[model samples]
Target chain A: AQSVAQPEDQVNVAEGNPLTVKCTYSVSGNPYLFWYVQYPNRGLQFLLKYITGDNLVKGSYGFEAEFNKSQTSFHLKKPSALVSDSALYFCAVRDYYGNNRLAFGKGNQVVVIP
Target chain B: DTAVSQTPKYLVTQMGNDKSIKCEQNLGHDTMYWYKQDSKKFLKIMFSYNNKELIINETVPNRFSPKSPDKAHLNLHINSLELGDSAVYFCASSQVEGGETQYFGPGTRLLVL
Candidate 1:
């Protein structure tokens, strides 16, 4: 089964500092990875995805993710974090050959302190 | 305008009662999906429809039935709601199935008392 793992339960970082939310995946064949962020009481918002192509993918809200095929990881990153960036982040993987259902990670709560 | 919209943003109902949540997508997407976000914030896919056809149905209970009246509308109806059913339900849509980015609605928070 295809699955995603976000090892960290919470990550705290200071404003303006670089932040990273780690994500690793286990899937057969090439993986389709995605990063989603959720604000309090809001639905999951798309941040970035890696289907096929360059290892680094940029997305909305100044977010970017690096896809590492060798490491089987797709980590979400931001150059400078803001207090507003504090939210829950989820890493999801889609089964390419299956029913196209997405399996999401447990989610990591990011706290960008001002 | 909201690309994907869900009715009853917050729903509080008594146990053993029936409730329904409606979803609509104006993006002209052919695929719509329902996901449940539990208290731990783990998202799980419940059902999916493509062009009014049921394509992907997970191991959801029979009490939970999804109706897709048209390509643009998908509704979830639950009978005899249980406490475990109290979670955030999100409706999403994509231009196509698989490898497509899904646009999500604000989500409906259901609380079974």
Candidate 2:
């Protein structure tokens, strides 16, 4: 079984400040990880994914995530924060050899204050 | 254009009633899925259909049935809806199976009284 954890329920950041939303996963075999963001009353939108290759994966809207193997973490990071970046973020992991289901975290609410 | 879409964005019904949520994807994807988001915002996969065939069925109750009449549509039908069954149901689709990015719909919020 594959699982993901976002320890923090919410993260507050001021505009122009760096932001980080933490995520970690446990899975069998190679892991196909993903990050998604959901706005209020809207569906989740794919931000980025880590399949194979680079540890630092860049995504849409100036967002990036670092996949740390030894730490078993995939934390999202941004150089600067914007009030519009406020939303709910989810972390997911899919086991390569398993039944092929994407297990998601409880989600983290990000509030970028202006 | 909307890649994936679900009908009846908000559904309010009484317990023991029957209801259905419809989903469709227009990204020419072969696989579609149904997911449930509880009040605490926990997302879990309930069912999946690839090319009109049932592929993934999680620990969902038998009262919930999914029907895929065609490749682009997968509808969920619930029999005797219970209060515990109330949640936001999202429909999504991916281009392929096993490790693929899924496109999600706006979701249908079901509230059972």
Candidate 3:
């Protein structure tokens, strides 16, 4: 079974500071990982995806994620946090060789303080 | 233009009543899916349709039925609404041939009284 775990329930960071939202995964073959963000009362928007390539994948809104095969982790990062970046983040994973279903982690609420 | 869209952004109804939520995607994708998000924000896949064919059906109850009129539309009908059925339902679509990057719709918030 493919699954993702987000350890933090909430992450607090000051504006202009680097922020990290932790995510780890377990899957059968190589994993296809994804990051999504959701604002209050809005649908989730795709941030980035790691299919197979360089370890670091850059995505929308200046967000990036690094895929660590040994650590089985794909952590979302932003060089400088903005107060508008405060939202819920979700990490998802799917098996590369098997089903199309994506297993999602419990979301993390990020608060960027001004 | 919205890529994926769902009707009845908010629904409040009594238990044992029947209701339906419609979803449409104009992205020209081959696969459409339904997802349920609980109060705690845990998302679970309920059903998926690919080109009007049932591709994935999770362990959902029989009271819930999903119908895909075409590749672009997937509608969910609930027979007997329950308190447990209250949650946010999302519709998403992706090109199955490509890497699985699903685009989501503005969710429909359903509240069963």
Query: Which candidate wins on TM-score?
Result: 3
Clashing pairs in 2: none
| Model 1 spans > 4 angstroms off | none
Summarize candidate 1's per-residue lDDT along B58-95 as a digit string, tens digits.
99999999999999999999999999999999999996
Top model number, lDDT: 3
Model 3, A4-114: lDDT tens digits are: 999999999999999999999999899999999999988999999999889999999999999999999999999999999999999999998766798999999999999
Question: Candidates' DockQ values?
Answer: 0.79, 0.79, 0.74
Q: Rank the candidates by TM-score, best first.
A: 3, 1, 2
State how far residue B21 of model 2 sits from its true place (Å): 0.6
In order of lDDT, best first, we have: 3, 2, 1
Candidate 3: pairs in clash: none
Chain B TM-scores across candidates: 0.98, 0.97, 0.98
Indicate the worst ten consecutive residues by lDDT in candidate 1 chain B.
B94-103
Position A4, candidate 2: lDDT: 96
- Superior candidate under lDDT, 2 versus 3: 3
